[model samples]
Target: MGPASVRPAVLVDFGSTFTKVRVVDLRDGSLLASGQAATTTDTALEDGYAAARRSLDPPWDTARPELVKATSSAGGGLRMIAIGLTPSLTVEAARRAALGAGARLIATYSYELTTADVAEICALEPGIVLLAGGADGGNRTAVVHNAGLLAGSAYTGTVILAGNRNAADEAAALLAAAGKGCAVTANVMPRVGELVVAGCRDAIRREFVRRITASHLFRDAAFPVRMPTPMAVLKGLAVVSDGIAGVEPGLGTVLAVDIGGATTDVHSVGAATRRAGVVYTGLEEPHGKRTVEGDLGLRSNATGIVARVAEDPGLATRCGIDDLDRLTAASRQLAAHRSTVPATADQYTVDAQLATAATALAVGRHVGHLTVQHGVTGPVRIQEGKDMRESAGLIGTGGVFRHAADPESILKGGVADERWPSSLRPVSPKFYVDREYCLFAAGLLADDHPHAAFALASRGLEAL
Candidate 1:
């Protein structure tokens, strides 16, 4: 298409604190302009979106884009609680599914639900309850019992049943009798040591979209907000990692860490590199995986980050946090005023330290680690989770990284060093920053315009 004939697309992200807007050229996937405004979820999402639109540069502010797509994390995002039979197998599977679906997992309960557990679940009032237990055709008692408990509780949210196939009907019938909303999907752990979460993830996405559409903020037909913000970022990262067949060259293995107000999310896309003399255990890691560290946030949960750093002296040293009392005070102040930006040098240092610590902790939990097991012959090495040591690129998102003077220093906190030989973190990754915050935009365009999405990701990711 000619340059004059080329159109532009508008992408929006309704984050908890800020509503970000980006305008991109549909022809070459080049970013044209961007704007940000405080999110007004309590009032109306449209208000914030309109303000962001008005802040755009030049023609983008006045001209109407050919299409508008949005992703949101407003109103505390999609809050969910996961219930499963076991902590290791089913509960972990449920957690993965919930995180992959872009839901903030508030709590997780294992085994049978007690009265206290049900009460806590009711009090939390999560938008969705992911009920998963046992493999297909395995134990059915726990799942069925949990369903009955949920049905009898004061919780009025949707219950997603992703457990034993044998007990599906009974559980559905129980929820139906109680007039509770339930979505039945394939078991998250269909068999022992197998994790199949795509079905549950899809179900959660459906519920999320339904919730968004039902809300007054997204009632306008002109604005279509589809997936959650994290989900969009995940999709965009996947596209960058695994390029379109015969169209673009993939970036091979890649990692992205999004540090936010309430959580820090780590996403990796690529296969775990097979190594010699290493035995894989537990569930096989998904090609596209995401893990959210609820306690590792820069704003709302800054105190948690400070506490974590204080607990681990090595982490504190690595993050260059020598003054725990100062960090603690700053974290408390930042938590109290969530919108406060780093003004003084001390505040900037505090933010950097928190970001570094959060990146290190979150990525450590997300990546796999090696352990030695004594076998018949000798000691054998076992690996659990993905090995991301060979990741081609590491991208840092969020305000901390985008506005930092040295983003590479914060990004390096997640890299594996000689001190932790077992961690499977990227050792020598090419660092990049999402300066324009166009990952969501690329993701929104990926399905229909693969080439454009790929081009956009390639251009938008600024190498450090």
Candidate 2:
């Protein structure tokens, strides 16, 4: 094929366990052929990419996708531990910011954290450590105290100070003076409830790039191409929504659920609307819109799923306690392993059920936070009139989601659905592919046809 007709490209979809390569014909968005193989984690990347594409694609197309890039949760991604001033205050905001930027918080510490806590943070071997405290100027002492503790810990990684802005520069200098390469960013806790993401996001990305390049583990520079699997999924979904739904689709938000072995991620996005020309009592409206609930995930927090499934009598009656423990454990393994779940009947049933429960739970929490809520024992699908479909696109992702045998199992056939209650809009579910994250074909499409990318984004968004 000539240069114009050749339009040859490479699409790399990095999953937790595997990576996929597709050779495409851009003229009509055709996936002319494809390649897929396990993520060669332990080997040099130059050879690994070569090996993965050896059989799945041809010589030229396999060499580089013209777009030889990717998204992943597999490796070279941020693994962190966050210390917050309050239990569910700054910590929560910090968590959301981390998630939005694609970093995974292995653990979160709130008030009254002790030396044992600092010792523990040092042991996690995370790529980075996020320290956020009482809102700006609110808890300067605690923030400084935590900074002091981290300065002494064995955490050789970068230390990001995201607390009282007034003390930030001093804190950064102090940490630097303490022999730690300090990273200073805007306060994660700009206020009590709202999170300010710009500064920290930049710092995290920079720290991430620096850490990967410095680590003996990443030997090859392929590390920088890694996008947080969730963030990649989020970006892909954003593209899909913009293309498919258009601007004035009357859609309020786009809701996505990624039910993993250890974490379930639910994101709700929509146009920001102010009520009565006045701000509400307890809400952070950014650009008149919002994205909520990163604390409520399925994988690492599987026990939360048990508490949720326990509350739903119908869901509870579906299985035994032994399976709950086993399932959660498997999910945790899945999160750590970061790969596809087998597509078999028995596994499929369990996967679907768990995903449904996680999605419903995450969505429930996100919606309720925008309003207000009780504990997991609360008996409500959503707060009164809170509009679950504010962002109409309902994209389902994660290992189970991409490989699940039947998505309808959780889509609620009607009111008789034993899973989620009837308040949330039942928009048709869809996916975008970041093979390592979940194979929703986002990579393949993005490789073959740039035009179709946006069209795929808006799938299933009835309200948007």
Candidate 3:
């Protein structure tokens, strides 16, 4: 490695609530300085970026780095709509790709498009449309039909065409003829039970960079935005699983839970293991998997959580929550003040309870559930999600896990809840927290400086 300050780069993540900045020594991956400021949504995010940049204490006075890399979810992140042929086949694959690409799914449609669907699309006005249908060599009718519908609609957002390979050219031509922007990627479901997602994921990342760069936030910046915050976190987790520079020992299989204001995202990277008597259905699970639960968040979706808990007597009893009005009041208070620090132990407990509920619900949805089905042939046990029983590590990110008074206990309770379905839960995995919020920065650096990214990520995380 060169001198400590030889090549320093600034990493920034623009969250909806805060703008985080980290100055790192590219030569050694040591964090030189870090700062955070309230994210400004009224004006260009550049204002908040400038504030965070100026807030850094050290190295700023001595070293001036020209290279600045960033990721963002400031303005509600990336919203997406998915259209596909079958609800359980290609449509499900498209949904997975959209979430993996760091997008919030506003809506999903399968089979033929209707006039009502067109009106909803116009109303939602998503940033991107993920058009997927049919296997690579199996079918083409649904994809072609959907392409025509989009081409004739009022939607002008970029369309990522990832359907049957034979139908790709026709889909693109249809969109192009109507003067609509679209990107053609590899088939998401190349075969009946196989999912190919890397192409679509990369395409969405490129589109994210393009869309953000075109906005007022980073339009004048020297370099384009790298990836969405969630996407970068997912990449960083992969780095954690796969050893960097062939030196660090790999953490075999790991799961990460991020509890945020508007969503709780769960990511797991593991080897697919088949149970003795269970049968896998639909597409096989990817080695790296991500599932986002928008209805399960601490702040923005707290009301939903409150209602869910109230509806379930057992869950409410376990959470020690009663009085629906009081719970709703607390949820509203936290929602209004996104950055509120718990003033008392009671306040802290309430916050931790919310976090625990969010984590459990999100993780349960992410992992697969088991069901017994009696088909014409015979009885079979079918699994619906990625199994994580063999995960070697469990990571907790976001404000609650990072800043809570007793984060360790909160994470433990969330992971060990029996209320969630038992098909896919971590089995005594090592727990860690991203205390300094370096996961995204590490992910941004993973491609170029694997070893350095590994070092930076390991430093910010505290193994529990």
Error of 3 at 199 (Å): 1.0
The per-prediction tally of clashing pairs is 0, 35, 1
Tens-place lDDT digits, model 1, residues 328-350: 99899899998888888777788
The all-Cα superposition gives candidate 2 an RMSD in Å to the true structure of 6.2
Per-residue accuracy of model 2 over 1-464 as CA lDDT, tens digit each: 22445555555555555665555544544455566777666774444556567756444434433444555555635797777777667776676667676677788888746899988887888877788887776768777777777777776877888888877876677688779877778888777767687778767766765665455535665444544555556655555544443432423355566665555665545544334422244335332112333433444455566567766656644432336666666656544653444556765665566666665655555453223345586633223323444444465555565565555444332112224443444334332322233224452354345454433333322221
Clashes of 3: 1
For lDDT, the strongest prediction is: 1
TM-score of 1: 0.95
Please report how far candidate 1 places residue 326 from its true position, in Å.
2.2
Question: Considering TM-score, which of the candidate structures 1 and 2 is the better prediction for this target?
Answer: 1
The model with the greater lDDT, 1 or 3, is: 1
Winner of 1 and 2 under lDDT: 1
lDDT of each: 0.89, 0.57, 0.82
